[model samples]
Target: MTSISILKKWNPRPTSLSQMNALLLRIPVSSPSMSPRRYSTRDRELQSAKLEIENAPIIRNNPGLSASVFRNLSKFIRSYDLMDHMLKVYIYKEGEKPVFHQPLMRGIYASEGWFMKLVEGNRKFVVRDPKKAHLFYLPFDSHMLRLTLSGQNVKNGKKVLEKYLKSYVGLIARKYSFWNRTEGADHFLVACHDWVWFSCINLILMS
Candidate 1:
């Protein structure tokens, strides 16, 4: 199957609108044909994590998890534990501030700002080397994007936002191989703007 098809099959659908703010795509890792020395460290680590999650034993009567909250409490707990211990993300250092690396901490969308701040400042999950990252982060703030670009008096603000995001994705794809690897199946962005979903629909449909 094509990479995008694989991604569509594995990517989880958000259960509610709240979950849509942070859409995390799943990366499919096929068994490597190359020798251990030739294989990339990121791929090896991701494959290891996948295997562990798949093989995790199902637990019953978990007090911390409610059946109403989780579809599969056992798998959810296992995944969370694995993510805590092994997940490494690399944030791209492209684009300017206020719209790119900067966060807006005083608005309804402030949660997105806080998330970006915490993740970027985090030392444990944030890695300097992209080769060691299991996932790639595009650290643009949706609130900032709307604030900065909406003032331009563009005829269609939504299209402008979409174009800007598409341009950013294109920029990253040309400069790095990660997006090209699985057609951005492992990349994620957190946005809280109301129009973000519509604006980034094209990017979301990429894989």
Candidate 2:
């Protein structure tokens, strides 16, 4: 079945978050497959960009800027140029509001929210096709997850947040072939919550 159809039929259980967590935890690790040779195009492009950056000449035109500040000014310039010209990101549309696809534009975590809004709406780097994407964005707000799941109570918040994130990842992993292709190596999340460090680490390790 098509991903869209599969997504439509698949439903998250409303019994409890713990039950959902149990189901998500059982999502098996997908075996690496070599069938999708189309990804090789992205690999080639990255290699080309890397070579170009490595061979780039030093930018001595800026008299005010010192080379000491940057490890390699030429490489940095080339990297930025390549990213601006070629980067394409695919955002999954399977998530719901407050936690996914919604941005929190206030408070200390505002940067993550603003970044999500900008990137999701961006035409230059965002692509609708997963095949053309160089990266995948998991658009979940950590702040919102905390608020929606745990509220003012902080007890076991870390575990709750981690489970929710894991469940989201599991959903996408099952809905699309992208996550399994790289085993989430190309997937990224924008989270700035204080507990993000530990939660993200646990998520990655568990995934």
Candidate 3:
């Protein structure tokens, strides 16, 4: 057979990721790398944005890739700055992409959407209708005193649990007439710390 015919007969598409990588390596193709000088400073900042997602435990726990979470993580990583991060996240619909952001940090933070949505929902439950009941946000010192004066040990005790507990106890409440494990006790258990901090714990713990 002619050389042209031979080339056509032997040509094959790489069938696996490893094979694809080997094929690309054989070619003179250049991909963006960790070269400090290759990309501009702004490009590096954009790349750093992915760190948030990579660091998130939810993303790390995904047995497989979660596309939606990855996309959102990419968006946050590409944010121009922390302020930009806040604005783009809080001001815009998460489903939309910002081309202005790119070269996201890396990896997938698999768990943010589920957690954040629950947080927002809990907040809404507190303020679904402001006109119906006056919302009072009391500081911790005042809250403690209010609890003390009212003779409620919700804040001080470890087990009596007049207050929310570390475990699912808060959600499971030892005395609920409608208590059922299926009633979203899991979510409460997972997000209890977040709820405390949001209310007025006044401290943030990484663990």
Candidate 4:
């Protein structure tokens, strides 16, 4: 949904309206629900806490995630009033825009305006400037994570991620092999799949 539509739905603070606008425009056409429509109380908490956990060790998983990505995520989280506005946006509000002030857990937030556009840049960026995607993916981290965590819950997160990739439009990630098998495209494994262990794993889930 558009940011204006979201603003009308929640009646939230005016300060967030601009941030919401900036976030909504970056959503790629493929992922419609790329935006959220608020969640139940339990879900809100999970998303908020998860954002915190992700910011901590996310760098280790993906060395490609640059310091700027980390800075932006922390800055967003610090502004969003943590889980307070997070839950409000999920439960009381209509869309995910209210989350701009919260921790930058996922790329769905898109608060940076310019950053997400950079993330969506040419695939050449993937091979050359891998770090750019990290800033863009931070907002959608929650849903990307949930989709990955679907089947088995805790341990399932990894495999669930693989499953999600297989479902993508072109399924490039699906057609590619991660472990050196000849079944899928070599590029998918080296560029996309490895990202899971890298910082943009959550970002890829968002894409």
What tens digits encode model 3's per-residue C-alpha lDDT throughout 74-139?
434434244243221111111112211111222242133344334344433334331221111111
The best-first sequence of candidates by TM-score reads: 1, 2, 4, 3
Whole-model Cα lDDT of every candidate shown, in order? 0.76, 0.77, 0.31, 0.36
What TM-score, to 2 decimals, does candidate 3 have? 0.19
**Model 3, poorest ten-residue lDDT window?**
92-101
lDDT of 1 by residue, 142-199 (tens): 8788878886756676667777888888898899878777677678899866467655
Q: Better model by lDDT, 1 or 4?
A: 1
Ranking by lDDT: 2, 1, 4, 3
TM-score of every candidate: 0.77, 0.76, 0.19, 0.21
Q: Considering only N, C-alpha and C atoms within 3 Å, which residue pairs clash in candidate 3?
A: 49-77, 50-105, 59-109, 59-110
The residue-level lDDT of candidate 3 at 12 comes to 57
lDDT of 4: 0.36
- Poorest stretch of ten by lDDT in candidate 2: 29-38
Q: Residues 1-207, candidate 2: write the lDDT tens digits.
A: 322344466643566656766886797643343223345787678768878998998786557567666656778877988999999999999889978899989998999999999999999999998888888898889878777987644666666677777888888888888877777777888876646755565576457
Candidate 1 stretches with Cα past 4 Å from truth are: 1-39, 204-207
Name the TM-score of candidate 2.
0.76
Answer with 2 or 3, whichever has the higher TM-score: 2
Instruction: For residue 168, give model 3's deviation from the true position in Å.
Output: 64
Predicted structure 1: lDDT: 0.76
